[model samples]
Target: MLGIFVLAPILIGTIAYIIRDTWAKPLLFLFQFSYVAFAFSQFLSVKANGPIIWNTGGYTDGLALSLFADSLSIFMVLMTSFIYLAFLIFAVNADYFHSKFYFMFLVLEGLIMGLFLSSDLFNIFVFSEVSTVVVSILIMLNKEKQAIYDGMIYFFVNVIGSSFLLFGAGMIYRTFGLLDIRAVSAAMPMLEEPQAMILPYAMMIVTVSNKTAVMPLFSWLPKAHGTPSAPPVISAVLSGLYIKSGVYLFIRFNQMFAPVIDMQSFFFWVGFFTSVMGVIMALGQRDIKLFLAYSTVSQVGLIVVGLSMGSNVAYWGAVYHIFNHALFKSTLFLTSGLIEKEYKTRNIHEIRGLFRRMPWVGAATAFAVLGITGAPFFNGSISKYMIANGTKDAGITLLLNIINLGTILSYVKYSAMLFGKSREEQPGKPERIAAATAFVLGVISLFTGLFGEFLTEFFFGIELQVDTAEYIKKSLVYVFMLVAGVAFYKGLLKRDRILERIGTTELTFNGIITVMTGYFITILVFLSSVL
Candidate 1:
């Protein structure tokens, strides 16, 4: 059954590609929906019966290939399914939905599912590499000159990352005589020389950090996510779902190596710096897609910080934020694509009067902006509050607030497109299905916050106690930040020369690789010192 979840999509997508008919898309969509339903049922069964472990060779010993689905993996599977479903629905109206595009997209989706479900370290590496190739093809589908360059950069960087991952997996296999993550984790405590594991840990984590778009290794993200040639749905999936695969691996490997090394503090600080730098870069972007892309970098940083905080509440908050970010950010990207399609421009400064011209898209965009900026009664606010509540230090709490302020300020510039006089008119009516999908996502973003406590408990079996007084206090803080963000944008950011330079500047392919190398070495040194 676990194999079915991973293999069914690949098979169906391949068949669809072979058919190459006009009806291939609808047929593919039906197959995908059926697979998602089956996967959800499996998820529920796992939830009721506990983890399901499948040994493909039917061997009970360590030599067999293993796939395991626990609460966490199944949850991710469900999230991936829903996001892909939304993307598919939007793609129904897209012009680029050819047989080859769906083929690569489904292949990528299946590989990601395999990544989440596979318990073997080698399997994870294999899945990661295959997904990287498929995603690069999708990135370069339009064959634009800049897109080709961005796609090559993305491809080579990930190829390097995957090679590191494979090396790390080989080390673990040699050390433990087993490649299964569960088996290795069980054996971790038995090792007499835990220090021997440090090099493997560093290699694997540095690679995962690059995947998660951590600072210094994040240069590929904005390029890939904001590539004008890629479809909006592709951008949404890349930002919302693809990146979380890296974060999932980070969490998995960190826990797997907990007996040998604990570097939560290092990751927590890295996440803080990433969040700060991400938003700073976001504040300088004039292109709407690039702005959202950098915001994703910042949000991923916040998620990392929450997970590394050593508090269960904060950890769960980070998990919830992952889901919330997918909802809001995907909506923002999809809606931005619609706006760009209508106006034939990507510049935020040139586009105007979305509210008057396309009210539904405008409303959805507004909700997404509010959700992302941590507005009171929005989904981001709840997750941010939970993460903040987990912090013991005043200084860290203040830093969290500053990150929130930065988020608000960046969106203040973004929200400009929602209002003002129109510069051009759209030619045709918008696609109803796409508009409806975005609006539904926007509604989910709002309702997720309104019912945060119940949903958190339902999803993760973690009870959250809401403090009304604290909520009120945080609301006031949000209001203050809202006012302050507006002032900062109007008075300072609008006139800042340095920010413009930082935003407009991008690293070359070699520069990105250099940063990744530097980050890997830094991690090695830091871990050596701490351990």
Candidate 2:
């Protein structure tokens, strides 16, 4: 059953490509629905029973190749299934929704599920490497010069980054004499010294941090995610669902080393600096896709902070936020495609009056904006509230508020397109299916928030009480931040030369590889000193 999650998509995708006819799309949709239903059943089963583990070759759990599905990993698989379907529908009428695209796209889905469910360290590295190649292919699907350059850079940098993971996995296997993460974790208590794992931890954290796009090493994100020639759904998946794999690995890897290590404080700062840098760079983007890409860097920072908080509430909040980000970011990216085509431009300042020209798309964009900005009753607010409530430290709360403020500020620029009069005389006819798919997902962004508590319970199987008074207080703070963000954006961020240069500045491929090596060494040095 676990392998089915990884195998079914690849098989179905191949069948879709081979059909490559009118029947192909119908078959794809039918298979997609079945996948989602099966995923949901697995989620429910994980809740009702316990984890489902499979060992290939009928070997013992610790020694054999392993597939394990618990509450968290299965839920991720289910989330990917749902969004991959939505993305499929979103691209149904697209020019690039041909057989080859579906082949690679569905295969990417399976690879991501493999990342979520695989318990073997070596298998995780294999999945990551393959997914990197698949993503590069998707990026280059446009076959334009820019896409090729960006895709190549993406391929090389990620391949280099993944080597660190391979090394880390080998080191761990050598030290613990186990390849299974569960097996390694269970053996941790017997380890003679914490220092034995520091090198492995540092090596692994480098790959995860690079994949997660934290500061100094985040230069590849806008280039890869905001590639001018890639399909919008590619951007959506990369930003929305695919990047979460790094985050998922971060959680799992930490657990593997948990018995002998604790580095929450170090990572919390890493997340904070990343958050600030993300917002600062985002504020100056003229390209819509680039702006959104930088925003993702910032949002990932927040998720990292929550995960690093060492509080269960904050950790789950980060996980739930991952799901929320998928909804809103996917909606934004999908709608950006529609808006870009209708306006025939990608410049944020050049595009005007989306609300007047494309009412449905504008509405959907507005809903996502509300959700991402953490407006009351939107899904982002609930998770953010939980992250804030994770600690009583006033300074931490203040820093969180500041990050939220920066998020609000960056989005203020994005939301501007939703208002004003169109420069075009007449609007183009809306793509009905695309518009409907994006709109439906946008609406879910709101509904998910309205039922945030219940969804958290069901998705995570944990009942968490939200203090009404505290929530109200946080809502008030959000309102204030909204107002402040608007004022700050209009007053200073609108024309800041420093920010403009920062946003445009990015590392070349060689530079990115250099930074990756430097980051790995820094992590090793830091761990050596502390551990």
Q: TM-score winner among the candidates?
A: 2
| CA lDDT of every candidate | 0.89, 0.91
lDDT of 2 by residue, 112-132 (tens): 999999999899999999999
For all the candidates, what are their Cα RMSDs to the real structure?
A: 1.4, 1.0
- Give the residue spans of candidate 2 off by over 4 A: none
Compute each candidate's TM-score over C-alphas.
0.98, 0.99
The TM-score of candidate 1 is: 0.98
Candidate 1 lowest-lDDT run of ten = 421-430
Q: What does candidate 1's lDDT look like per residue over 1-531, in tens digits?
A: 789878888888899999998779878889878877987898788878898888987898456888889988888898889888988988886789888888889888899999899998899998999999999999999999989988998999999988889899999988989988888988999999888898899899988998999987888999999998899999999999999999999999999999889999989999998999999999889899999999999999999999999999999999999999999999999999898888889998898899888889998999998899888888998999899999879998998998888889899999998888886654335788998889889988999999999988877878899899999999999999999999988998887878878998889888988888898899889878876
